[model samples]
Target: MIKKLSKKLSVSLSKSLDGNNEDVEIWTYGLELLLNGTIKFGLIAGLSAILGTFKPTFLILITFAAFRCFGGGVHFSTYPRCLTFGVIKFLILGSISNVKGNMFNYNLLFYVTLFLGILTIIKWVPGDTEIKPIKNKEDRKKQKVKTTIVLILWIIIVQILIRLNSFKYILPITLGALTSFIFITPLGYWFITSIDNILDKTKVKYGEVK
Candidate 1:
C-alpha cells in the first residue's frame, strides 16, 4: 500500500514538473501538492491562515509573496512553493519563539520542526553530492541582493503586523515569515540539491544536460 501510494505521488509530482497540463490544471496539481499529507506544509498553511485570520486577504498575499520570492516557480505552480515556504516558515517561527521567551503552542510547531529537520538530515547525509556549483558570480550576487531585500521587507511587515496588535494572528504570520526564512536557508539548500540531482539524472538518462 505504501509503495503504491509513493509511486502515485511520484508520478503526480513528475507530471506537475513536466508542465504538460493546462495552466488551470497545473495550478490544481500544485494545490494538491501543497495540501497533500505533509505535516510541514499543513503547519505552515495553518499558521498562515491563523495569522491572517483577521485579514485573510493580506495573509494570503503575504503567503503568495513569500512562496514566490523564496520558493522558486511560483507563477503557475503553488504546491511545491507552499510546501517549501511552510517548512521554512515554521523553522524561523520556532526559532523566534525560542529566543523571545514566548511559550508557543507546541502541538504543530514541534512536530513540523522535527519532521523537517529529519528530512533535511536524511537528504543531506549522503553529502549533498548533487548540488551544482554556482558558476555565475553576477547572477549569484543579484540573487543575494534580492533575497536580502525581501527578507528585510518581510521583517518590516511582521513588525507592522505586531504593532497593529495582530497578536491573535501572530501564529500564522510568524509561521509565514519563518517558512520564508526556511526556504532561503536549509530548505532552500535542500531544494537546490534536489534540483541538481534531477538535472544530473536527466542528463544521464538523455545523454545531455539541458
Candidate 2:
C-alpha cells in the first residue's frame, strides 16, 4: 500500500510538473522512504502511549537516533517488514526497561554496554549496505570519529544521571545504545538478513496458497 501510494503521488506530481521518467522514479523512492519512516514512528509513539511506556520508549528512540546518526546500519528488503520489525523491537525494549527497574545492577549494565558499544564502533562504524556503500576512506574515518565522540558524550551524560539518582533512565539508555551498535556488527547483519529471508519466503508461500 505504501509503495503504491508513493508511486501514484510521484506520478501525479510529475505529470503536473512535466517531470521525466527518471525524475518520477527518484521522487517515488524518496517519498516511499519518507512515508514509511513517518508512519512507523507514529505507530511506535501511539502504541507506547497506549501501553503506558511512552517515557522509556521515547528515551530509547532518542538514544537510538543519537548513535545511529553516525553509524549506518542494515536495511530491510521491504518497507512493511522494516516497519513491523522496528516497532516491535523498540516496544519490547521500552517494556523491558520499564518492568525491569532496579531488579539488576544498572551500573554494571551501563559499563558493559558502553564497553561493547565503543569496541563495535571502532571496528564497524559507518557500516554500509550495497545500496549505500561508503566508498570514500575519509568519509568512513569521519563517521568513526563522530560515532566515538557521541559514545563518549553518552558516557558522560549517563554518569551525570547516575550521580543525580536518576536510575530509572539508565536501562533504557543502555538498551538503546546496545541496539544501535548491534546493527553494525557481523552478527547484526546476519540476524537481520535471516529475518528478511524468512519473511520473504513466508510471503511467497502465502501468495502460492492464494
Candidate 2, 98-210: lDDT as tens digits: 86556358877887888888888878889899888998999999999999998999999888888898888888888899899888888899999998887778879876310
Whole-model alpha-carbon lDDT for candidate 1: 0.47
Q: What C-alpha lDDT do the candidate models reach, one value each?
A: 0.47, 0.87
- Look at candidate 2 and tell me the lDDT of residue 15: 95
- Cα lDDT tens digits, model 1, 86-197, are 4554444444433322335533553463354344223322121122333455655554555455545655665676678555455555455444434444556567557656
lDDT of 2: 0.87
Candidate 1, position 60, lDDT: 36
Per-prediction TM-score to the true structure, in the order listed: 0.36, 0.87
Model 2 steric clash pairs: none
